[model samples]
Target: ADLQEATVLTATAEFLDDHTVRVSDNSGQETLIADRIFINTGATPIWPNIDGLLASKHVYSSTDLLVKDKQLKELVILGSGPIGLEFASMYAQFGSHVTIIDKSSKILGHSEPEIAEQAKNDLEEDGVSFLLESNLTGVNDTLNGVTLTI
Candidate 1:
């Protein structure tokens, strides 16, 4: 919102000793006379702590890769929860060559076993590879494109 719409109205002022009145600004940033002050910066996505994970250019966040790419030859999804599977399904439908990896033994680990199996079957039938009980050890750039070492 425009600060021009705001007025310097006094909130519940607290006077410490005789000299100072604490102030509040409704719109956000605050200031004090001395050099000491605290400023807050809000949220940013936390990248996984995998080694060399941040250095690669082809490495894209779930937001960028999922929403932007209509089609791709292959995908290596790192998680197998609902969110990761959802992305896998959407991208696979969009004709991405997809692969999903997780440390758990089953794809839908929390779901009913039979249902999860059926879902896994459907996904595999549609060409999504499930790498279960696996760990992503490293990532390497290959001649053709990118290779994810799991």
Candidate 2:
């Protein structure tokens, strides 16, 4: 494949000058000079500031949930965006009790109302719960599970 023949360097890239870039990895460092350079930095999940949430060991970002192989019985998602709803749907299909809380009036606030309602209905049929106009006030990690106060 073309990818197999490509030279891929996994490292932190920094623009040294207009035509130079510095890449550093665990192996060593390298300076690459080119007329044009492209950067493809990925996005990271942003965690909200809720009381006791930062201190809780059970708190996980969306990315963390993707990489982890834990079997969850109950999941409390803090947002109702596309990513959050997707996770809710997946977990609900996996037989987890999924609850999604959002500060808006409905899920997928940026999408068309009818489409969003249809998606919400489908998720609800799958046993997903939604708490609209709700804000997470605190979090408590119990011995058996984590409790979220919304």
User: Each candidate's lDDT (Cα)?
Assistant: 0.68, 0.83
* Model 2's TM-score against the true structure: 0.69
Q: What is the lDDT of residue 83 in candidate 2?
A: 83
Residues 2-119, model 2: lDDT tens digits = 1223377888888889899999999999999997553434346777888999899898888888786977988989888878887897777777899999999998888889868988
Clashing pairs in 1: none
Highest TM-score: give the candidate number: 2
Clashes of each: 0, 0
Native-referenced Cα lDDT, model 1: 0.68
What's the TM-score of every candidate structure?
A: 0.62, 0.69
The stretch of ten residues in a row with the least summed lDDT in candidate 1 is 34-43
Candidate 1 per-residue C-alpha lDDT over 37-141 given as tens digits, one digit per residue, 9 for 90 to 100: 222122334467776677766677766773673457778888776667767876777677888888899976777798678778878887899889998877766
